[model samples]
Target: MVDTRIPHLPNEILYEIAGYVDDEDILNLRLSAKVFEYITNDRFATTFFGDRAYELSPEGLEALVKITEHSVFAPHIRTVVIGHGGKHSSAKYHDLLDQAFRNLAAHGNAISIGL
Candidate 1:
């Protein structure tokens, strides 16, 4: 249910509250109500690929690509951190990273990759 009280608050207050939480929480809050969605837009969200970036399963990589290409979330994503855990072959990680980079680039994101 949408909290009517939040939407009534000043936008400054709402954004101040949002700044106290992590990006994941902000994303969830944005989904909770229209008011939150508007407030969250000020800071956008960070999409962290977590610690297993190099160990992602095929399905995980597909999901990552999907999110990166999503029109709604794509614009809000301010950061994407894909790290290597050294458990996978270099070629596999490279392929995954390359695909992700392409998806992001196609969506107008500029990224720098370092080996």
Candidate 2:
């Protein structure tokens, strides 16, 4: 069973813990509680985008853009990953990414293309 009477964590330590997790984990942890959310939302609001740029199609692009454009994640993103897989023969994916980057850039974060 989960313990309900856990000791309170020190402020400095809790903020430090938020620095080590990947972006996805941050997203998960943010939803766990308001305290965790405030700490993480302040320290790790940005994400690298990683290779996740290749994982979307046109419709997916729209969805992805919409998700990131939300209030909680928009300003938190400081960096992004925008590289496409070489195995793709068609330029369609690249075009999709280009447009996505345009959308992502409009929000005022640093964009790392050719990632």
Candidate 3:
């Protein structure tokens, strides 16, 4: 049973939780409710998105593409780094990198390629 004594989470609390995790988790949580989506998009919460978030959701990808294609992030994104964590960094990784490059290129506003 739910405990009534535990106060409902304030927006700040939700925002903090969302902010602490990476984009993938945020995307999952965003689907949980409208409140959660608001929390992650709150001014303070958005600061947590990492520089290169992979294993990404289409939602996250769309948002990130919007952000980086602008002048604010355009100059900073000189390279796109694509690789599986740890031991998987081989031809498979290269192929993934190529796919990512193709995606980015089709999007075409990323400005520079790095990998």
Candidate 4:
């Protein structure tokens, strides 16, 4: 009897199977199994973190900080898009923006910023 369970497959075969799927499908595969997630970690980091857009809100900036600090995801970031909905007049917003930029500078992986 052929054991055809997904986890029974070798990493190379799983990787090849993952290569044929779209981004959304890949995400689903990752969620479906730990082995899939482990094999696709590099691809996931590159595909998702290669370019990201965030609103210029406290939460968005905080998320950006978290990503920059991530050892695995940081190196994959190539571009960051900052969406300023409108002019932010609050000092707190400015402070957050400043801090976020500082973190990005330290990360030094994101080479492009789209405003």
Candidate 5:
């Protein structure tokens, strides 16, 4: 039988490494283990959303709003980068953007929205 255990890593080390990983990889890491779940969370908002501001979509915006719904995860988001330029500017996209901002505003954390 093959050993499938992951090496133990400090949270600080994991967080540092996370900065270089893309959103998909970071989200995947969050689901790998309890420790990684903790590690990925420390920078979830910034790493996942901030790094992919240009590629934001309605689905992505919805996901971001869902995370900010949590009190623990909400404060990690200090800056929100919203890209208004999209090839398809549909009503659905606008609705998602509005909802995302409203959700963030409800947190009352004074987040700065970047373009």
Candidate 6:
């Protein structure tokens, strides 16, 4: 049997390998081993959550709230894109937007918001 397990590689080597792969490949690598998950956490968070876009709806705001609450992912978020696609005058929509803005306000790392 060929001993080709990836976990046997040093963490430095694994990180180097991660740096060479694209986002989809990196996600697959994370699924392949726990070591990959541990080593690629920062890169994964930064790559996927650095700039986020969400629709101006309850569902989208909920997702944003969840991401903002995440300790690992929240800090990596630098910009947010809120699409104004739905009805703007609904009270529920305004409420969710208010809540989302509050959450984003608390996320000090977030620098820009696009509408």
Better by lDDT, candidate 4 or 1: 4
Per-prediction backbone clash count: 0, 3, 2, 0, 0, 0
Global lDDT of each model?
A: 0.61, 0.57, 0.49, 0.80, 0.65, 0.81
As a TM-score, model 3 comes out at 0.31
TM-score of each: 0.51, 0.46, 0.31, 0.77, 0.48, 0.77
lDDT of 3: 0.49
In the predicted model 2, the residue pairs found to clash are: 45-76, 46-76, 46-77
The sequence of per-residue lDDT tens digits that candidate 2 reaches over residues 57-104 is: 456556556645666665555444443355444366666556555666
Q: Which tens-of-lDDT digit does each residue in 7-112 have in candidate 3? A: 3577566766776777657667777777776665643233442235543334434455554554333334435443334534345345444444555565453544
Total backbone collisions, model 3: 2
lDDT for position 81 in model 5: 73
For candidate 6, report its TM-score. Answer: 0.77
| Backbone clashes in model 5 | 0
For residues 1-115, could you state the per-residue lDDT of candidate 6 as single tens digits?
A: 7556787887788889888888878889899898999998898998999899988777888898888878787888888898876565446677666666676677667458898
Error of 2 at 56 (Å): 4.6
Candidate 5, residues 43-95, lDDT tens digits: the string is 67655443334336666677766766776666556776766575555465776
lDDT of 3 at 8: 58
Could you tell me how far off, in angstroms, the CA of residue 105 lies in candidate 4 after the best superposition? 5.0
Query: Model 3: runs farther than 4 Å from truth?
Result: 1-8, 42-115
Model 2 Cα RMSD, 1 decimal: 6.1
